[model samples]
Target: MQNDLMGLDSVLSQISDVRQSVTDMNAISIAPNPLSNGAVGQVSFTDIISNAIRNVDSQGQEASQKMTAVDTGQSDDLVGAMIASQKASLSFTAMVQVRNSVMMAYDDVMKMPV
Candidate 1:
């Protein structure tokens, strides 16, 4: 029972790490610059979205590699691989939720009067 609890704790820790990454991605903001024409920060919306997609993709690839390694008897950390797979799944789900919200907002705006 103790080992099971420890495993659960480790999985929870991994989940929090994924959540932190998502939070950090959302925390991107435009910083004020004194030398520029009044344009926003260098980071654009497209760049942020693209970077987030790349990050999620990398995590998924890493999880797949871990699973393959475990299956081939190259790695003994099955629990770690499962945790990584769950983390990747959660991140992908979060990204999908964000995309859905964005689409809903866009639809709402399109329905508004000019």
Candidate 2:
């Protein structure tokens, strides 16, 4: 009986929105800056990784806050809180899986004769 507005259309729209934003952000960075620094073409892997970690942490915190609000009688949107928490959990899981894959690739490369 909870409001699961995560219908197919809503989910598809969200995916499209995310894809558009990612493309837009990537385009901004890839564009040649008129007042370019020497590091114009350089994208720092560490920076990207750290930023992703921060984003995941923020999402987790937001989900926690939402759940807290729901539990403490501050907010009554239980479905929303559950959705947020699930989103945070899924993102974290995806990040972990990516990390594992990267580590496996690194290990395989290290074991190569080259």
Please tell me which predicted candidate would have the highest lDDT against the true structure.
1
Q: Write the per-residue lDDT of candidate 2 for residues 1-114, one digit (tens) a residue.
A: 234655766888999999988877742245557777633564677888999999999999999999999999999999999999999999999999989999999999999996
Which residue pairs in candidate 2 have backbone atoms (N, alpha carbon, C) closer than 3 angstroms, thus clashing?
none
CA deviation > 4 Å runs, candidate 1: 1-29, 32-41
- Candidate 2 off by > 4 Å: 1-41
> Positional deviation of 25 in candidate 2, in angstroms?
23
RMSD per model, one decimal: 23.8, 22.5
Model 2 has an lDDT value of 0.87
The per-model lDDT (C-alpha) reads 0.92, 0.87
Candidate 1: C-alpha lDDT? 0.92
TM-score per prediction, in order, is: 0.65, 0.65
lDDT value, residue 80 of candidate 1: 96
